[model samples]
Target: MLGADFYMPTRVFFGENALQRGKEMLLKAGHHAFIVTGKSSAKKCGALDEVTTLLQEGGIPFTVFDGVTENPPLLTCFEAGAKAAACGADFVIGIGGGSPLDAAKAIAAFAANQGMAPMDIYDDAKRLCPTLPLFAIPTTAGTGSEVNPYSVLTLEGGMKKKTFKAPDSWPRAAFVDPRYAYTLPHGATVSCALDAFAHALESYLSPKSTVFSQTAAVFAAREIWDVLSAMPGEFDVEMRTRLALAATVAGMAISVTGTGFPHPLGYSLTLLDGVPHGRACAAFAADYITYNEKSDEGRALIAAFAAAIGTKPNVMKAFLPGVAEVDFSFTEAEIAERIELVAGAGNYQNSPYVISKEEMYAIYRAHFLKK
Candidate 1:
């Protein structure tokens, strides 16, 4: 009796030269394009060059906003949106990892609805104005922002990261050329893979998971884990392709179930402790899986996930420490305060079981304090 409504509208073009499709999508979406990206990776990976060449060849006017940072701040979106509005750009092209892609969605919203306050990006109760059409070109294999409507924004003066989704915020198209990932650093590749795997793992264990979402999650978990386990060696084009596809599939899965504890609780570590977004989220994933598996209700779900990935339930734990470590130092009171934040998160209640404050604290302790 699996029942869930799934919404995925992004037209994905995945292959070695898939980016050539961006020219047509951009042309169809708008006359002028606003390209959003981070400072380095997009430029380093050659995605920027390829995309720009396509736009140029297509005779489409465009502008590049490369101010997006890791854990992108709301100000950056506001700034880029204002720029886009001023330039009369009709569409957005997000060309990087999750940060840029997420920021691009927010930028499109802000750009189109120039009259709305910046904080209104989080007003889920209000019907938001439609965003400019967006096209994503992912240079990294994680966060899956390319295919989802969620845009995770880090507010400058806020305690936790926030996300907003307008129906039109889903990217109109995505160019997932795994060859773009060939230039990724080893550590970044591993971290992104872990992030992708966490998405699959968390969503698969969600109480709201449907058969379709679970299938996508399981496939993503296996694909990400297998490629990640063989890293430090040069990645052939096929391996990179599979890894990128894994992240995208994971993103699609989470779009249906949303995320659970790891993502909500991981925000503090990422924002406050300067942990990488993927690594921070993954730090808590293993314990959460164990927590779920030990419960009567979650045992079947855990077994299903293990079978899908072709491994024991705890195999992820063995791989996690190799990807990222919990090295933060926090006092008991500070730890309690962080736990309170997790308790207040919207997605905290999305866990398969009701998470008591004590249990939440224990999960954090298992990852950080004990390590």
Candidate 2:
């Protein structure tokens, strides 16, 4: 049994009217707020305007620092942190998609210090100081960044992305509302949904899973799968609740257990090919189980998860447009090139089973067929 220690410090306000309580939350935290956003869309969506009016009415001195990008970069984080400090923002608010929310976490940490950020994330142990108070306002129902403890950032000229975390990495509070994601683009919608699914699958199968984490992941997975199974529908409160809850639960699971090889491999697809995080992983779901779940118990658990989502045990068979075989079409040279990079990831060591580059390539080719 993985006698894991778990604790979530973020004060979460859930459901439909949660955003209405933002100003009250500000007063509780004691602050001048710095709002972090991805772009002008938050302003166009009137979300920025709405949050501003609320903070102003409550007399919370606030400023907006809006330049976060998809797959947030270290420079973006440093720039945002500088802006927050320059504005004297005592409390930080992230009011866009997961990128802004993740940016907020790093910005909060970096803002508390007064020095150049570490050029190498692996070497930047001193860059992450104790963070200022953070409020995560998730505009999208995926990535679950609002409720998690780690931030995934793209390093400058780095071959691989870096995951940042410490005891102080958790958000101080999270304000999640489904209404904000009602207008998400179709591709974004698919990508985010896929990201949530990876969280569930990874959390569920981790040898680090505890009874508490597994219970939470199972329910979250069910809800996320239901929402994805029936797409292009109006936002269901239940789905939003599940996404928020799943993100939080998965976040907790990762805090203790961490993730496996698919995540590192998925990064390659996202960075190199620009496949969104979630979809890239989904493309490999069937293969992930095949290569990693060598145990009968593991396969049974995966089959159960698929059945829960209305898919069969052999769901992976559908991914192959032609015949199924161990041989993949990717050049062996290409697979050999990334073998060490994927294997070297810290998270890959956390996987229950030992994985090699050949297995990783097999998993990738299995899901990437052009069918």
Report the backbone clash tally of model 1: 0
Question: Which pairs of residues clash in candidate 1, taking residues 3 or more apart in a chain or in different chains?
Answer: none
List of clashing residue pairs for candidate 2: 195-278
Off by over 4 Å in 1: 124-128
- The lDDT per prediction is 0.83, 0.69
lDDT of 1 at 223: 87
User: Against the true structure, what is each candidate's TM-score?
Assistant: 0.94, 0.87
Residue range with the least summed lDDT across 10 consecutive positions in model 1: 362-371
Candidate 1, position 10, lDDT:
92
- The top-ranked prediction according to TM-score is 1
lDDT of 1 by residue, 50-140 (tens): 8788888878899999999888888889888999999999999999999999999999999988877778787754435688889999999
